[model samples]
Target chain A: MGKRSARLENEMIEYLPRMRRFARSLSRDAADADDLVQLTVERALTRLDQWQDGTRLDSWMYRIMKNAWIDETRRRQRQGRHLAPPEAGESVGAEDPDFDKRIRAMSVERAMATLPDDQRIAVGLVLVEGLSYKEASNVLDVPMGTLTSRLARGRKALEAQLNPDSVEAGHDD
Target chain B: MMIDDETLIAFLDGELDEAEMERIAVAIDADPALTDRLERLQLSDQAVRETYQPIAEEAVPDHLIAAVRQADRDTAPDSETVLPFQRPTGDRPSRPAWQAYGAIAASLVIGVLIGSRFGLTEPAPLHFEGDRLLAGGVLATALDRQAAGAVGEGDTHVQLSFATDAGGYCRAFQQGGTAGLACREDGRWVVELTAPVPAGSNGPIRTASTALPTILLEAVDARIAGETLDAEAEAAAIENGWSGDPD
Candidate 1:
């Protein structure tokens, strides 16, 4: 109805896809990730003043998403055992299911999930969201050294799993 | 100083000093392996970026815009009135009382509607819990180590155990009373229960009296085969170095 309302609405519209992609990275399931992003949008709108102009909007939204996910995770704990996929009888690997591609994606996702929450947050911000290290540290509320160590270890672990071949494989790849 | 992979990732991420980048460039030039790895890492980063790049290019959804618009409208009035909702003690008690009564009634009705539709009164949190919960410390550590069918002692508690049809072990877990689930992947436990489970279930009876919660039962069903791990079987799984099919 008003100028500020219209501008905020436009900004939210612009953020959907990026928010969805980040949600996807956090949640491997397409549907679940979309739900998470939608929830993020709803919450960010509800708490509009919390967001300051000139701050990284993506990071702020991400903080909301992370908090939402954490809450969801806790709620699910009561009966949330990992469900087994239907017994497809030897579940053929997609016949050219691109096993390597799936493995690569899963490997990276799994390793990233394993990182301590703060480190994972940092990795997502810096490596995934393209936030600078300084920005990530500020977002994560950690000392630069702490953030660096976490990032370094998280990167190394991911490298080891995602590309475990040459001596320098884990180092860079 | 000679650069390592950590330094290389830092460099690629622009965390490195200019001197460090120059040093790594020299080392990369001298070492074919380093150069190849750098190229691959860059390519991987590029690929991840590319995979998500389309999101930035895609059109934003309309509903999200509408929600934000509605929120802004709601806030505008509050912005104008420094204490819009607060009672004016000096006003005619009857007039203020009626307004207060009306607001309270409206809020109560809205709350009830939300509760029923979303199962908000159910045992679990209806929405996000802010920062009070998420995997942390020892819980994070244990999830990293356990794979399907394996259970180990220590910081993490395996509340329930099951085997996947894929022949891997999966466990419904809790850390400091916060529930989660992790399954074995590539000989390591990978967590999959970091999101909320949808409402309703077949309501399976849990053997562990103090089991994490029923929300995690679906996770167990998803991966458990045969009977669940009894105390003895669970102990065996832990004792035998945690090697077995989750099924």
Candidate 2:
């Protein structure tokens, strides 16, 4: 490998963890998420020439994964295969001391999975992954305003689901 | 000026200009309700971050690493330039040049159904039980004993082993032009998704390659729970006869 390719490989490996996290949110399943990450890495490496210098490599990868996921979703939809809702509150290891915390986390994940695809990606990128609005917009190929709206709606829905008492008081309105 | 939820969100994200940020900071300081709103939003963001934090800490599976490396190798300039038959030493001897050429040609056409990868000199009969295709003959033997990522003597190759959300162990396998994802359920390897390999596609099924077909990968993904088993776990699963929770 040339110096540039070596550097890119290193950088890609460094981003793998975060990429995996982002993918888990988008894919809502560990295996699928990792597969998405793998596909993203493969696509990025093959199209390294297309990645413009000075732009964020992570954002470029996020775009690739998002697109790959979209394609997968479309294929599944065409096959009439719907995602079965994840089994709720699947135990997170028996030794875990923070059982409540784990349940709450699983709840959030389930709630996030329930969001519409666009809203889920927007909230996941901006709120969870900490991507800036512009970066997320670029990743999703949406305008900034569209990204913000999705984030707002997703966040609202998540908040309602997570904090039902607050929502019962009409806080969602 | 009253801050709207969107403005507060932008403020939280640090997306606003200096003047707007300062104004929101002042407003937040003066207003308890606004402060509560900001805190709630921040808490939600923190929760979301925390929920996904574990995934980052989990070890990346070896197959993904191998795939990336394979892609790197594929992209390297020398990869395309060097042929399997090309040798540095000009000493051409034992076998005829035509034999060497034939070997090279065969390797080039590795995954075609008629090629050696399929291991079919004559048409091999396919056995099926109703609509479910049972892995009989060589394919069954591979599923019964072959370790993942290990090239079996038979045409079938098991690629990955993982635990499905349904509490079963599933394995992805490929044999020449055929590939599928099978899960262990009710004491049998149930084929979840199978299809004939597409023409001109370099998906993992066609070769001992790590690049998985999108459809097969999706099938595996839809079923798997946490990450696929690493090498050690996969070996153990195979030893336990593909039972995820072998008692």
Candidate 3:
């Protein structure tokens, strides 16, 4: 946390909530999401020097979160902790657990979990997190074109999982 | 233009230009089924966002922040020169990045494994250009030109260099201040590996002043094609006409 990346630091702090949301969506568990967020922050802080001034802060943060999520998942799998849900609650509104919110959130997490790591991350960044194509691209350190393609495919795949009927409907249209 | 998912998504995110968004909006209006499908996409996005929104808003716990800050403090010492391949010693478990790579390899031929990670591969070995060249310049030159015997008790030293069978090269050299290595092929010398060779063992990492480390040497070996060079061989090879690819 050098004082030099002051703007970046401020941006990072401001965006922590969004980053946490993105991480939570990926990890699905409070503890794991927290760990992922911490790792992302640590990495961002350490490598603050690598970030260019012109780039969007959210994209860079997303990339860090995505990488951290991948690493954490790999570590968990290596430790044979795959089956246990990473998060304690099933839904985002787990604290509430009322019917509509609970049902939607649980289904979303379940569908999200079924996705391959890359696809899930792309969807999480672009759709769930509402990152701009350019912003998500910078975070992934992928070319903008690559990010767009990934987002397109990821969303399509997610739709197939969450609402297979929609795919058929999509084809019919 | 035909509607693509990227275009649709850009529309969904409110990122499309007015024309693109308007075009999609017209299409959605024209087809009831398309409107339904787009609505589902939007709802799903809302659902996911709603689910994770709490986590986002919740304050970052002090413990997590504290742990990260501690890791920063712990690693700050070696942040600048932490090589990618050096292993951790018993004394320092929280090794820097390079030492962590080396520590991971300590179980086996850490050196060779470390070499390949930095792209000093067997067939298509990595060559140093701008930053890499500056990063490992003198040490690479010393490794190519000097022999162990010629290494002085002074601040710089040449430890090793060899041309592998595959036509790539690897070297381990040291600034008397820092023990490290440099390897060359096709006129480009990439510092693939480095470590503090003890002055006794060459005064190990603490004594080595140069930035290149032994972990990078492992990277070099992982990619080299044939055996490395001894002093005499390097001299002879340099004297003969040289080209980027080994003949």
Candidate 4:
């Protein structure tokens, strides 16, 4: 491997943890998210020339993951698979059957999983991944205004889901 | 200037330009309602952030790591790269990834942070000294010894090591499903706060250094002064006994 490729690979390794977090938020499934992350890694490694040297590698990788996820979601739909309802997302931590009794503090993540994919990705990229609005917009291929609106909607949805009694119409312009 | 939810949220996310940020900061200081709105938004933002953050600490699946390592070797016919494989059940991934490294870290990992047993289990890596709770056992050893991202023989992995503006260092650490931040002071690792890391935040994930619980993150944000150390800086800090530069 060339020295540049090796350095980039190391950077890619550092970013895997965060990329997985973004994938889970987008896919709303752990196993599915890992698939998305792996796909992104493979794509990014081969397309190293396409990634601009001065640009943020993480952002480039995120865009790849987002595109891969869209492709996967479409493929799943074509196979007659549909998204499950929000109630089904309670199994987000599905690996642990005892999740209810074990992790009471997970209401936040549960609420997040209930969001629509666009809103969830907006929230994940900006809030969870700590991407700036401009960076997140580029990653999602949306305008900054679009990103903010989705984020506001995602935040409101999460508020209602997490604290239904305290819901308010505070998100409207 | 009218501050809509988008503008306020933009300010909250640090996306506003300096002038806009200053304007919002002043308005927040002057208007209780604005401050309340911002705080409420911040609460939800922090919660959402903390929820997904634990995923970063979970061991990156081996296949994913393998993909990255083998990126330069793409000339080889690695058909498995294109195929999805069942998660290795033999790894018993439910436990935090600490066990994958060695027995010492596995042994010193958290017992139980859930329910009423929080912070009360035996082999707890922390205890109180006077009014200050300090790192007692392996957590202390890890904080004292491990550089950032180096999961050594210590029970804890120091995921991040950064200096505060006050010339002291703080580290974000994880011991199994337990994660917290401790800053160096008085030659001791003072525990600012510790919280139960959601065991299933991501793929029933655990181990490695973690993103702190919201409260600990708030504390770190308030104190870190925007000086998170890079690897070289972290190594130098460790060589200097986890203290920030004298200057």
Candidate 5:
């Protein structure tokens, strides 16, 4: 580890909670989620010179987590580590009913797994995390329209998972 | 009243300005379908956020806190910009940037240094055995007996002999109106390159015989570890079988 300012380091620590939340929202596995966080922190620390002091640290952190997740996902795909697919998320919860937190985490992971990487991240950043569309798009490095479209698609997918009946009822509007 | 989903989303997320929000609000008020669509998007988001609440509220796993606090083990900040291609100073002996291209043909006869001083005459057909030049024929005879300053048979002259930074010996010479650089490898001379010999060439890289082509001069500059072998050193190299002894 090279020497970074204590201020930057402390600020990064302050933001770890939401960073982990965003990481979990992107990655399906807890271990992988934490791994993404670890990778992002390491990257951000190593590249602290790139960060401006007054800018939103959360925004910068989110972008790093996003890029790190993409790299991690590609590596995992290359390594054939695609973790038994989304179907496993549903069944694993049923089999391990005693762990409530595990069940809740798995259920969220299950809902998240319904969307592709792009849409899921859009939803995670905008709808769930309450980033303004502009900020979310900035984090995503996408235009506002692209971010909204992905978020809409991601919401529709999660809506289906949440209220299967509403989707079946054909909320055509 | 038929707003696209992205526009509707921007409206629902309050990303629109007051005017656009007002317009969408009026449109939604008049259209139950729009209202329902907005409701669904909002409800889905609410439900997802609720599901995620526990994760955010859950105690940051001790492991994660430890990871965040473990700054000493984390990157210091410049490592991320370190170029991916500039690998650490490593043993990069992988067929280097030093590309020497030429061929030793079995029958493509070379206009050898017809050296009378070395008792050599006429051209020789030098061939490659496994890409290593077999110092055969008149050229080999000139090189083996008197590789130093042996301008024996014609205007051809062995201008200089020097050991390379790569621990190999190279000889620069002009023959048959062509200049060439040959470096010793595996006990045999490999004609690294040969170009049409230039006349009166004084390149910035060196001030040797102007007749020495710039290619040969540059080749010597690129390879010579220290200095070209003096006459005594060249004689000693001949005595040592030119065994890459770095004389």
Candidate 6:
């Protein structure tokens, strides 16, 4: 491989874990998420010329993944396939003291899944992936204000579901 | 200066200018209520990060690595000029073109299963007794002996076992290259749905139903009476020969 291609490959490998996590958040099933990540990496590698120098490679990859997920969802819609219901808080950890924590985590994931696709992506980018607001806006191709509003709305929804007492108390102020 | 939640969030994310960040810092130091709000936001951020932190520790599937390697090879300069008769060395033996196409077709079936999250793939070559699909070959043995949480080295592995709402028991199994869910009806394990197992997926049985393929998971969701059986329950069920009528 050329030095440039090798560098790109290394960078993509480094991004794989985060990409898989983002894909899992977007996709309902683990298999589908991995497939989406595969497709995203393949597309990115094949079209590396499109990526601008000096830009964050992770952000560029995030954009590709987001677009690929959108396309896949559209295709599924056109095919009239039944989308899986949101995960219903299936406990992840084996029988242990940490099981409760795992259950809470599952509930959080389920709540995140309930958000609208746009809001979910916004939250995933900003809160989950720790992307800067500007970088998230760039990935979503939205204005900064739009991104912030979406994040606020998504965070509010999450707080309502995950911590109703605190959310209610905050609302009184 | 009164700081709004969005501005506070931006400041937390380091999205604001240095001046704005300093102002927020001073305001936060001066105001107890604002400090509480900022702490809440910070906690929420930490929770979100922690929720997905486990995925980073999960093993990467080898098939994905192979795909990346294949892309690298395809992009190499001499790859285009390689002789047709010359096969690549150090790789597994190449299958016939038809088998390659068959794998692609199976992959597409798996894709459909992933998208719809429920449905059966094309049937493998299993002996059928009338219309009722009886577990044959490795599938039959796995259904007979494998416990829900146990991970067997054989080609057929039973991943989960639980009771259906109909008072019958169902088990999810992966055999050969496909994964599926089967419910016991009239003493026979009837196949619900099967799809090609994606590459590098041979790991321990997943405790999280979320990791399951949508179709298999949907079938489980539709039939499960309550929560899936815990490990102790599953072991007892296995001991009882997976009798749908659990005591």
Q: Which candidate is the best by TM-score?
A: 2
Cα lDDT for residue B165, model 6? 75
Model 2, range A1-173, lDDT digits (tens) per residue? 21223235556766888898888888766667778898898888888788887788999999999899889999989999765346633422223579778777777887787789999999879887888999899998889999988988788777777776653224432
Once fitted onto the true fold, the runs of candidate 4 whose alpha carbons sit more than 4 angstroms away are A1-4, A84-106, A167-173, B29-32, B76-247
Per-residue accuracy of model 1 over A1-173 as CA lDDT, tens digit each = 11232234445656677777666556545556667887887777667667887676767788898888767766766667432222312211122367765445554555555556556556666777787878777766778878788877666665555566745443443
Candidate 1 chain B has its poorest 10 consecutive residues by lDDT at: B199-208
Q: Considering summed lDDT, which 10 consecutive residues are worst modelled in model 5 chain B?
A: B199-208
Q: Write the per-residue lDDT of candidate 2 for residues B125-148, one digit (tens) a residue.
A: 233467764444455556767776
Better of 2 and 6 by TM-score: 2
TM-score of chain A of each: 0.74, 0.88, 0.80, 0.81, 0.82, 0.85
Better-scoring candidate (lDDT), 1 or 2: 2
Best-to-worst order by lDDT is 2, 4, 6, 5, 3, 1
Q: In angstroms, how far off is B222's CA in candidate 5? A: 61
Q: What is the TM-score of chain A in candidate 4?
A: 0.81
- Which pairs of residues collide in candidate 2? none
Once fitted onto the true fold, the runs of candidate 3 whose alpha carbons sit more than 4 angstroms away are A1-11, A53-58, A76-90, A161-173, B67-247
Please tell me which predicted candidate would have the highest lDDT against the true structure: 2
**lDDT per residue as tens, model 4, A16-94:** 9999988877765667778889889988877776888778899999999988877887888899886434454443344
RMSD of each: 26.0, 17.9, 16.6, 15.6, 22.7, 20.3
Residues A92-112, model 6: lDDT tens digits: 222326866776677667667
Please give, for residues B1-247, the per-residue lDDT of candidate 1 as tens digits: 3566678888788777888778877888898877777776775565445444444555555444444444444444333322222123343121212223233223233333443443333222111235233232233334434432233323233445665677666666632223467666544455565422221121221111122333465455545666565657656765553565332
DockQ of each: 0.14, 0.20, 0.22, 0.26, 0.16, 0.13
Tens digits of per-residue lDDT for model 5, B178-246: 556777776666777666543222222211232344455555676777667877888888888688354
**Model 1 stretches astray by more than 4 angstroms:** A1-4, A78-116, A166-173, B58-62, B71-247
Weakest 10 consecutive residues, lDDT, candidate 1 chain A? A84-93
Task: Give the residue spans of candidate 2 off by over 4 A.
Answer: A1-4, A88-95, A167-173, B80-247
Candidate 5: residue A16 Cα off by (Å) = 0.9
Error of 2 at B67 (Å): 1.8
